[model samples]
Target: MPTTLRRSLLAVLATAFLGAAPSMAMAGVNPPTVDDNLDPGSSIHVTKTVSTPVIPPRPDVVLVVDSTGSMGPAIANVQSQLSTIVSSVKAAQADAQFAVADYKDVSDGASVFTVRSDLTGDPAAAQAAINAISAGGGGDGPEAQLNALWQIGAGGNRISFRPGSSRVVVWFGDASGHDPSLGHTLADAVTSLQGVSAKVVAINVAGGDGLNATGQATAVTSATGGQFFPSVAAGNLSQAILEGLTNLPVTVTAETACDPGLSVSFSLSLPRTVQSGSDLVLEETISVAPDARQGSTLTCTTRFKLNGADAGDEFVQRVAIGVNDVTPPTVACGPGVNPSGRTPGGWQQAGFFQMVADDNLAGVSVAIRDDATGTSFGPYAPGTYFKLTQAPGRSGSTAVPFTGAVDWHFGFRGDATLVATDAAGNTASATCSVPPAQK
Candidate 1:
């Protein structure tokens, strides 16, 4: 299974389970503390989504032909259709170029290594150079393959490659290389290739009857983040090369959310985008608010775009996080027993909204507010003096405590506000008024 698919599954499962089971109920919502089966509070959800796209790149191809005694058939096939390959690539990238390099054995004299033609955008020139190469003069099972790569890679870009272009070296061969015994070692080739940011895709067609096809080509390809085809024929080589050149990578560019309580961090090791033919894991971490309600989902989104892709070519990921909320209590007001005229204070009942508002209870806060002393529960605005006092209530009943003073009087036609607040910042308010004195 792909890593992306697995991550997606986990995210879906989390949402699925939350909707199905009561085990994921809001945290800290104790049922015994409220009047009726009540709910916690509202919470936020964050979701993220990822996107992938394929964008082709301008190609710089160095067709490394294995010009040895055993590679005549493949070389001829390549040389014959060389112009067609250039024509195909030019359709995608007008600036695409084709270069030529032929490799022989160390014993093949000065003809052992030759760059018949450097990089050129002209199809006719590339075909002529391929036609000029003739296969022969190779001894032993292994040839100077690494030496050929080292020479071409170490050479200046003017003669070998184009600067500011994607580098590719397609090495077609029948047998393995003579390790590092030639002019340069495999390590030297790797260094040169890395320095030029080039990849060598090796196609080995030599492991026939008696030839012990060594894996030097495959190793070098892997080292340079390229690919190896064990027995790819010459006819299919053009398609393979084209596919590798055009493959693309997309990456996360930005993320934003409405809630100020969430924080996100991207992976440090993995590149934001997936590389062609490579398995990459996109990682990120999102932290929830300290007072986030349990079982609440926090959603976040991420936007992605391909490297130099076409305009409006982008993708997105929606990520969801669940949490719990801290809920507040509920309160109500009633008439006071104080004598009329002088002053009158009201009695207010308060209950914690743990499970159900009125029935369940543990601790509930009640605020007695005048027109001036504005309460946080938002029943009254600030303007007057205030004090906290416990109200009469059935101990261990649904109601917890209420704030008020018997001496806190309201003049005739006077009014006060009863404010109720719970742990999770939830609030409720009630108005208590005194009738005019025999108006």
Candidate 2:
């Protein structure tokens, strides 16, 4: 029998025996467990569905600008275009908030890095902060922008990012950042960005040895799952900020962890985009290895993420699988009754019958039922089965007595059913008939 066919049979048997089979009762995952019997070299597919929570477009944007003499043009651009940029972002994400921060060289003392404005919904305050930035003085080629990123990303609510809002840092600079700024390494800065779930859209101003020229911009953006715009003109700083806020892509991915004998696959390719406030459907196929041991259990757990961050409780699924056997045992019995035999009490006419049984998988047992007498005998399993028939014995007084074994013989039999069963409960049967004793 095929694995699937056997599973069907088991289901029918379960319903017949237990009133009703239990439902797949589980929370968060539909059909919590995959309880099926799968034979070797066979497979089954499963589907998993998860309802993505609705996430409205709420953006918490922070503008980190280079405040060095060389960045005069970029600062001027932000002052001139702040209102337009805010309007554009608001058009897409109505709940967008903005903040402003600036950084100069270490020698600039208190001006090395400054939070010009905390995150706010008021465009005027954001605009005022940008307009007040005076670009000047620096003692080194590299600036303290790296330090600024670390502070904003890991500075303990320094920028005050709103809850459940998309965190973005629009960083525009004309110089590469110092490797170790204020005792924090580049890696430390990147970790900070990830810690706060902040994406840095780095806009490299001017073509010369700037942020991109040293690969700092690329590293920061890539590490934070953000974007990097290279060789952007200082005048287009505002455009970069607008695009960074409005055009950023949101990707959906599932992190699946499964047991050894089982493997899982999805209907849709991973790392795909899922729009905000939209539902995401994931169809997964679960399969067991052909060589897996029968009756072994398989399992898998998957958690969905949105843009490199966990999508929370509503987006999790778990699966459990079971392997089963399908093939039934085979049995053969005598076509006619055996010779009559005498016991200590009397002559047993229809006593013994020849029988043999075998199973493809092992652990074969037998059951015999005398239809005429309505008497049933057992499920004679392995060790006990072979011990059913004992040596024939006779009474001393009776000469040449025809002795027969106990249990194996029947007092009277017309037709009997012989059933052979295997360890998996699969069975096969044959009938043996006893015609009226020799007449």
**Highest lDDT against the true fold, candidate:** 2
- The ten-residue window of minimal lDDT in model 1 covers 25-34
Number of backbone collisions per candidate, in order? 54, 1
Model 2 earns a TM-score of: 0.50
TM-score of each: 0.48, 0.50
How well does model 2 score by local distance difference test? 0.66
Judge candidate 1 against the unseen true structure and give its global Cα lDDT, from 0 to 1.
0.53
Q: Where is model 1 more than 4 Å wrong at Cα?
A: 1-56, 92-94, 155-164, 207-212, 234-236, 239-269, 272-439
Please identify model 2 stretches exceeding 4 Å from their true place: 1-56, 155-157, 253-266, 269-439
Tens digit of lDDT per residue, candidate 2, span 258-337? 88877778777687775333334556667777776665677777776656555455456667777665667778663222
Superposition error at 237 for model 2 (Å): 1.7
Q: What local lDDT does model 2 show for residue 410?
A: 37
How many angstroms is residue 206 displaced in model 2 relative to the true structure, after the best TM-score fit? 0.8
> Considering summed lDDT, which 10 consecutive residues are worst modelled in model 2?
390-399
